[model samples]
Target: MLDNPQLTQTVEQLTAVIRLTVPVSEISHVMGPAIAEIMAAIANQGVDIIGPCFSYHYKRPSEIFDFEVGFPISRAITSIGRVKNSNLPVVKVARTIYHGGYDGLAKAWGEFCAWIETKSLNPQESLWECYLVGPESGPDASKWQTELNRPLND
Candidate 1:
């Protein structure tokens, strides 16, 4: 939904973050609620289809192999003693939209793969998720907007 190359940096950053990962099947069942809470707190408060998404780098090793479903953000923060989805210093990324359901995220990642290869770009060591919806709007996959991004490292 956004296209601003200057927003991403040319250099990669090395930082630690608290990331929550889930399978495609669990997105609506799990992350849906969690994201709703966060989205409600943000402006617009609407779930934007931001598009098919996949992670090339995790916020941390712990998050990489985690199945912390049904865990509220507060509980996860309390248990881990940190926030999982906050922004940290990261390398700039070339962002895009891969319109489709959660299952199509793989194809979105493929687009990033293509960008990296075709543009001769390297990962900057950081990525991000921007939710354009929240509980106010309710769960409607068609209205779900997710921004699939790839940080390019120089």
Candidate 2:
């Protein structure tokens, strides 16, 4: 379930990311390796990971998922392989937290968008998910938390 969403402003954040455009079915397959690659690259540069990992999607997912998987970093790093310097843009967004397993994300997003529509908010083409706690935390899926942000044009 998602917490009540609120409007807020986000500061631009520096990040290290690997961009990918793959079939929707391939998201689960690609996510793990992409996250691993990002973490490895960040470690190679001795950069401090300042925040939890996140996926910045360029558009709502359909047949294709085009997005960046990475972590917020203290400073920028030179590009290495697929890992590159990127920034989470500053924008106004309607944000909420979802507490559950990753498998419930699609449903969570549907609910979130429905709320946005009820408020007559104009959302951008993009959105993002910040993974606060997941598999690494424990075996309990009920305790997992993900922060969901949908950029708004208003």
Candidate 3:
């Protein structure tokens, strides 16, 4: 489900994001459109996208998902429509790459959290997933990779 998890640190990054607090069932319906709107705004401002699309969840999800979808940018950008300037702050994290389709994410995260527990690591409530390779990359779901990151508390 995922590669060997590793402890690592992330560099802070600037981004243009669209914040959404939607029901779990509504996530798929909103993801595409939110990403497109953010991309269009970034393109209009001529901001260089430095990373793939990612979702930064503000808390552990249950009936609702409060998160921001966006891409890391080279520099700051002005707010446009639903898109606004935001950032991924530097933090210590437990990171791994989930090798499968999106439907397998929950299982992957479950397995990952188990590993963290085994290692006695303290994890924060927030988490993020970077869509490294997905539907746009190819037709084979097995080849898709999603980078899962769970920030750790010191």
Quote each prediction's TM-score: 0.49, 0.98, 0.98
lDDT per residue (tens digit) for residues 27-144 in model 2: 9899999999999999988999999999999999889999999999999998999999999999999999999999999999999999999999999999999999998999999999
Give candidate 2's error at residue 46 in angstroms. 1.0
TM-score of 3: 0.98
Question: What is candidate 3's lDDT per residue for 11-130, written digit by digit as tens?
Answer: 999999999999999999999999999999999999899999999999977899999999999998989789999999899999999999999998999999899999999999999999
lDDT (Cα atoms) of all candidates against the true structure:
0.42, 0.95, 0.95
**Model 1, which residues run further than 4 Å from truth?**
1-7, 10-18, 21-26, 36-85, 133-144
lDDT per residue, candidate 1, 1-154, as tens digits? 2222333443332221234565545545655554444434322322232222223335321314342212112211222233233323445667765444455555555666566677767765455544344323565555555565566665
Off by over 4 Å in 3: none
Top-down lDDT ranking: 2, 3, 1
- Which window of ten consecutive residues has the lowest lDDT sum in model 2? 36-45
Q: What lDDT score is found at residue 129 in candidate 2? A: 97
| Model 1 clash tally, residue pairs | 18
**Which scores higher on TM-score, 1 or 3?**
3
